[model samples]
Target: MNTKLKAMVVDDHPIHQTIIKQYLANKGVNATTFGNVTEALRSLQGNTYNIIFCDLQMPGKDGIDMMLLLNKHGYSGSVVFVSAMDDTIISSLTCMCRPFTFNVIGKLAKPYFEDDIDKLIACVCDKHQSKASFQKQIEVDEREFLVALAEGRVKNYYQPIVDTKSGVLVGYEALARWMHPIYGLLLPYVFLPIVEKCGLSPELFDTVFSNAIQDIKLHGIKHSISLNVAQDNLEDALFSDRFLARCSENNIDPKTFTIEITERESYSSNVNLYKNLLKLRLNGVSVSIDDFGTGSSSLEKLSQLPFNELKIDRSFIQGITTEQKDKNIVRSICGLAKSLNISIVAEGVEDEETFSLLEEYGINLAQGYFIDKPMPLEAITVLNKEKKYV
Candidate 1:
């Protein structure tokens, strides 16, 4: 227990506030209690707390409102939702807060046990420690992206997507990587946001597409290649035509290409994107809904789109071995995809046990480090020739 640790409890109920305060006191945490969000906001002005235990259903401004306010004010501390809300609402709130760059410690339902408080305290301490150890990442800009593109530093790395049962390579996913002179190697997270912000997704796509075609031809790998398609690309009327032209120029069949639409992109009611996706499918290109279960309107998108594949998000897949809830969720997704005649690909399967479980669940395909890390073009070519997993 760190005596220097500080936390705030924001709850209207006297009993709930007392319980949280006592729990914090037991853990040697300096705790502040606020009965309303207004006073909490005032407290935040003059003080900094490492963790905040917030209640959802309050008199005036609700917990969601407070969280949004906290995000707006750039609160970086961990937040624990202590509420009586149903599991679905709590889970949704948890998901909502995570993307705002806050460490969501977890949730405690009303009538929580002593163990729940203990777990919450442990989670906060762990997250705080992890956050403390995080290094400030280098921010990338549009100029750097253009320079990288011109210098031929923007490249594609291939990660093998395999059949769950036989472990045979059925396809490969093209992951973007940057060979930065200073940084050595950088993943998509470093520069993708800048590309998206600058509306240069097409340039990035072109680089990956060109590299993928070259890799396939060089290796003579007769399998599908999946590339992430940004929402901007989908919205562009000429995107499909441009992509087909590239395939034709490279002597690559459109049937051997798959476009993966990520859940992170908000494609809500974008009719043009839907039509373009449909057009691609009509032209023998496969479309997959990537990161399947994490999005807000997953079911709606599935209902509206002509996606032939559903990729269970890594977040759920990573938890399948340890969490029953994750297993159930994945099982449900498998059932739903099967009913729709959609192929299922489990992402982030890092162990034989997980791979076996996915196979049992009838997952059609899988891609993760357990199969192979994203390899360079030469390495992919060698692996294709050998027909072996390294």
Candidate 2:
């Protein structure tokens, strides 16, 4: 509410205009009224509004017309369409906004009440955030990355993974982050490939492995912890011996750890690769195939390897609530994993609706932003105390 909302009301009817303008005025919103999309676009030329209250049924350049050109005119603010537009047409039009990189924040029919307008206003308020700090550019070179890693700037941040049915915390996936002193937080995709290309993947894994052990012991993290392994870590002949040696030194149960192998990275047919995987399994560490539906070799990889878990990628999980195709894909994956006697996890579950559908789909575990964002071990309060997420 403190964002200082500015709105553009596009409507042709004089009475509706007066009513909407009055409502906005009451709410302390600075609103500019336009009788048509043509006038609205003219106002948007060099000016920007936080949101636009657009009418659907207009003479030329209706709601659809305005939306199609909004991004082209450099208007990145959110939009709310007003009219008695059919739900079917609305669904179809919603797809168009994605390409324009703007969101249809809300919809209202004709003859709506003040409460409905207030609801849309609530949506706008919910989307606002505190003033953003200046973001430094993320560009990085190899030597700088190596220096950062050497300084122990690349560390593990854990995100919670919960049991879907009980909504109880079951585990956490240890993800890597570059806590660069100057560059801030740099994600894996930025530096991981560089590390792998420079044949430093095992070194990076050593850092993560050491950090996970230290965090679990220091934080008293009792839940399962999953760590992602690079392809090189598997290909190395001594990875298994070194890994088991560390686990023995720490005196932690191997069952407490899960190794996540992305679908694309497991193509190596090294004897050491197969040996390491088998040795880890024999020692009681669970192995999971991450990003289930994303790879071309998903089924073949599952068949070849002795995987204990299958993780449905977020790309598919996020769409199940709205896309029938995604729902069907997840259902098939769940059935396949069940048949294989394997547990399933749906990651990237950001909302309650998605999580509920995943639970209904028989997902054994779920993880993503909705459950929790990855953070330092100290920030995960449930690690120290039992907590229910649902």
Candidate 3:
């Protein structure tokens, strides 16, 4: 009946710490305050708090350092960063924490209002409720991922990519899902870094590719199936040959498939990667630039690489409905792709408004929850049979 939340506040400034503690107290949260990162981290070793409020500008150890240490210590609670820093710096630090596996709840800039603190507390509490669902995902490691790959537990879930104007299912993007014995269904983010680190990406890709081919054949679907390929896969000398051979054995048309290369990974100067991609294109397999606008030097890569499709990143697409800047960015990207004679696919089109905006921008394709969440092969087969996906 208490309904009290456990929280920790780490700040060198006594006044700010008191402010945060008082703010959290008002929200029915019992908060423990610390004046230094050392004491805070030591408390973390023995105590489990639902949320941690970290100050970015602290003496001895800053918030970023504490965040890295939190990951090192395997702290899995939500972290809220409090700083007077610029929005850009806060955004960058928040982004950095995510890759380290920290659950960044929200940020409180300096000169904070009481409403801001209230919002932060509410957000933290809301996120904490869902923490249990993700706790099992945290237990996954490279060994588990390797076992899953070897046991043929990696499965493909297909999300249909539709033509924007016609609303016709044009293709399906193969997303990897691991059928973990204990965890049930695990998304790619849960184990992909480990797969890449353990050099098992190619194996994982092969598993997904084989399943996708079968799914296409089983359903007698004629549309293309796009598979995400890593930089290492492209760098492999025999990758092209192996891929083409698999398609040949499966009796799949290379034209009915696409290889998606993410822009986040650097492939600008990889001669071998370029050669392999060129080989795929020559053999009728199209290449698409995935998450188009988020990466550095995207335009440069676009001009240099022989990609036929440009996927507008989800970040921009998700914002188009509410943010003017996002709309402008999506429009510009669509224009650029059109000028180059490249087809554009906007990812994360989650609403009718966003979909209409994308259509207005002349985006060639769209894919997201608005159309359909990724489905298992059986569901896809049903949809194909019913022809209801349009």
Candidate 4:
């Protein structure tokens, strides 16, 4: 017999509790119900769960608090947020709480039917398997020489952002990964911060840009290639000139490649940074404000710089369907971009609903797991050969 899917369902309402219990029971899940955070924590003390289906708004402690509690207990189960609150707010909350969160499997809107619950459970199961495999891969990677390999372990993964309505691939983002001989592949989180701490960020940036440029030329990719540059690298005259010269020497049009600076640094205290940016822009390189709206000075930077694109961060885009406030924020950004004639790309479209919502809201460009995950440059070459996106 298949083991029942174990879950903890938390909500203050008795009817909602009954509904979830009946729903889970129909799905062959063994669910424990809790009307409050204290009871939920108490239940957690005695047993482990495979999933937690929690309401966003409860009487006290709330959904966010419950997430923190789960993290504090080291409960590595999946979290499925099921709430009536706006999806955007829930999505935003999820992002805010992600650093301490363990395993968030799904986000289901409230007033959900049995079909929704079943689909969510199925999704969670699929995600659980992928996460397990991914974590195992990371573990094997942890045993390898990530530190030593960081020196020569430059890799680039191309993730496509297509026009939703036209389905045309307009651009690709360059993602970094570290491949170890023994441990397989180490993700950016494993070695990127370490590289920065070890004072190799500039070198790493060189490798990423060089490989990205080469890939663009090798695969005959004509669309814009987005590469992230560290704040420290932006101030280096030698680094910037070398980058420009590489593009010139390779005949790779600087206009087709965008150098992205995170929103945090785009609003830097250094007044001269704008001059550096201006110089690059004058040479055909486009600048982009990455992860817009996470920090202050978004309006200031947007007005001050000649940025060609504004990327709405995934945190805000993840749940715009349900959250009215989130929708408004996205709408505001889209409207602002339209007024400014700046191209907008919504990052992190993980589901069909989110993708559709962005398109409905007039966001043409999108990149995330729903379209594709970041993969090795070799895979991207295959995609190029396949001509999946023209």
Best by lDDT: 1
Clashing pairs in 2: none
Candidate 1 structure quality by residue, lDDT tens digits, 236-302: 8778878888888888889999999998567667767877888889989999999998778898889
**lDDT to native, each model:** 0.85, 0.83, 0.84, 0.78
> Candidate 3, which segments miss by more than 4 Å at Cα?
1-4, 9-28, 32-46, 54-75, 82-86, 109-127, 133-152, 163-168, 189-199, 236-251, 268-272, 293-300, 313-335, 347-364, 368-372, 383-390
Best-first order by lDDT: 1, 3, 2, 4
* lDDT preference between candidates 3 and 4, better one: 3
Stretches off by above 4 angstroms in model 1 are 1-5, 11-39, 57-65, 95-101, 110-137, 158-170, 182-190, 217-224, 231-256, 263-284, 291-306, 312-336, 347-362, 367-390
Comparing 1 with 4 on lDDT, the higher-scoring candidate is 1
lDDT minimum window of 10 residues, candidate 3: 129-138
Model 1 root-mean-square deviation? 5.3
lDDT of 3 at 33: 95
Model 3 C-alpha lDDT per residue in residues 262-377, reported as the tens digit of each score? 98887557878888889999999999999998788898988888999989888789767754567788888988998899999989888888888777888989999999999888
- How do all models score by TM-score? 0.70, 0.70, 0.73, 0.85
Query: lDDT value for candidate 4?
Result: 0.78
Model 3 clash count equals 0
Writing each residue's lDDT as its tens digit, candidate 2 over 105-177 gives: 7677788677878877777766654323443567788998889778988888999999998888899899889
Which portions of model 2 miss their true places by more than 4 Å? 1-131, 196-199, 264-268, 381-383
